[model samples]
Target: MTAAVPTVSDAEAAVILARCDELARHSSLTDGIERTYLSAEHAAVNYRVAGWMTAAGLTTWQDAAGNQCARLSGSTRGLPALMLGSHLDTVRAAGRYDGILGVLVAIAVAGRIAASGRPLPFALEIAAFGDEEGTRFGTTLLGSRAVAGTWLESWWDLRDAGGVSLREAFLAFGLDPAKVGDAARAPQELLGYLEAHIEQGPVLEEEGRALGVVTGIAGARRFLLTVTGSAGHSGTPWPRRRDALAGAAEGITTIERIARAEGLTATVGHLRVFPDAVNVIPGKVEFSLDLRAPDDADRDRGWTLIESALTDICGTRGLDLASTQVHEAAAVACSPRLRAAIATGIRSTEPTTAPADAARPDEGGSDSGPEAPADDAPRELPSIAGHDAMAIAAITDVGMLFVRCAGGISHHPDESVTAADVALAVDALEAAVRALAADYPAL
Candidate 1:
């Protein structure tokens, strides 16, 4: 359960943070971060990351799916690889560390391992996926799914907001659409996958801990719900009017109540009203529902309850309700073996102290600074947000370690993490690799 180094210094953590800021400079936006899939910005960052990987004694290449990949041989020159990575693409106006943090931390870990002059049971690989946020083309994990050999031919037809097809975008990025298959990795060519990511929720921050172990990624269902009712004049009698907006408001509230009662998450993040004007009653309403749970059965049961409630709300309001399911994904459990390895990593770790400017969560969520952590025991939690691991799960067993982020804020510019946590994260992941190596033959 020991690593080449017991603790990654705060100085190294500062370097990771500095690298993040440097990558942020390649964003498309003039004002904020916005690196989408296959954009010039993506290529620029990949080039920058490749330089870092090479300096760390790894062979670097860009896969057909446009993932930035690097490999370092173990004691055995041609053994299966243990891949460690997270996405590099992001939603528009994203924070500095959502996906970027994982990539940099992984580089630090790999760099340290190579510097140790010791080889593990398997080779090491890093993949900086180009598209996980799906901010540009409306498809999540395209990068990782391609690597998992799950790329759909129809994906070429998918277009972005500017009406550029994925196929065209690939060519624009100097990639051949026909060669994307080359990115796929065979199941036998790897041991397993591990991702170190921000909690992106307040659990760790609230509990005053620096790191946590992910139990599983939540199963999710997304839908577009429409309410139809007739528009009316502002002067229409209340008894005669059918207010779609009002009905939608009631429906959203009911969704919240049912989700709360069921211990699930149901969010109506987007809403649209037709015939919108101060002088007219709304004729129709369209809203989005995002439901998630750690268990597929529990998620389905919660959705059933939600459907019943929405039906009742619509019926009472004399409105017709219709729903179209847009997306669904089953729960992905982290491998028990890998989970144990991560736990071993956490238990053997210690925190590092850095200057305030090095890293600190100061905005809204709990900022636990470089203080002593709650306990050495692993804090286990489920990820509600989707990740690249969700797609990579198709090819291999996966595990994740969650680093506490500022107030659980992500996908925004204010996302924060302290250097103390980053240092601990690097230590834990490095130790996890060693732990896995020790048991590689049995695994």
Candidate 2:
């Protein structure tokens, strides 16, 4: 016989949705950075979230560095706790569901557990991380890294576009930079973590799936390229003068071609021309390139090609070239045990369908062979973008479940998801949390 479908009340789902809307309405984008970590807005939304946590029976508190926490004590108090949460902030012009879903769902899960009056095997702690987007400071995973004891003090000296240091930003938000170390927690105390999020990609929608089981976080390398050449009159013949803009254009095309040839992804998202005048040939051009891949070897190979192409293009164009690494993050793998739990939970919710396939498999091994039976359930895919869970996964076991977003659009006013998708994800999450907390042996 099929197992019963895990259900979440409409009221609970509505509450979670409402919280998402309310948080989005606030202008929490950090000043100057303006993409994430708005001080005033973070304060406003976090306060409301803290109040909600208390009402839901959690003992809520804010850490020295401003991470908000809500604790629900389990019968096994001395045991390591289960963490369920996501960041409260957003990228500049971010959508409501990106990070907010994880936080609100944790609240909903904790609330449901309390109302059910069932004793849990381990403690549950819901977290609303301070700033995962790094929209203000150009550094992502600010909160989770601190908790993981991997945060660097030099990060405090890094400045945003506005010239304000992270230390100063923390002070502006009433957090002490000197006390950042206080945020660290013993690794043993964190049993496991789970984050619910929007897929932020087209994989799920293209496959007609409701949810995705994430396997690993993609590695990213970002750089700023500056191409310098002599400026000249726009009226001058193209062959007579060295033009930086022309060289930059060639570099951009080369990057695209190399990334495609290597089967990696690269983007020239931002560009600027010196003087930016219509009449000038342009003395200098600056652009930003972001490259990403699933593993280090692939990423390194792609970057090697990128540099070679840039060097050759600059030499042929007689333009000076300079590049600097702006950001780099190594890929992180999810725990096998937690991944199995998520798959089991999803399959349990819709037993008629086969379990979603793992996005990544062991080396030299296939998760499913060519003749493997097809499942009625949709397949899960890996995420190219970064999220708070990536940071948490560095120090503790963490897993992620992604609900389908409409049209795969996110980080904009037009981003959205359906209520039905939300309901399904929440149901799966509730089951997963219960099963993980129940001490079921690893699959």
Per-prediction TM-score, please?
Answer: 0.92, 0.89
Tens digits of per-residue lDDT for model 2, 284-388: 999999898879689989999889889898898888999999889888777777777777667654532212232211124222212212354535567788877
Expressed as tens digits, the lDDT of each residue in 394-419 for candidate 1 is 99999999998877898889888887
* Overall local distance difference test of candidate 2: 0.77
lDDT of each: 0.89, 0.77
Q: Candidate 1, residue 285: CA error in Å? A: 1.7
What's the lDDT for candidate 1? 0.89
Residue 75 accuracy (lDDT) in model 1? 89
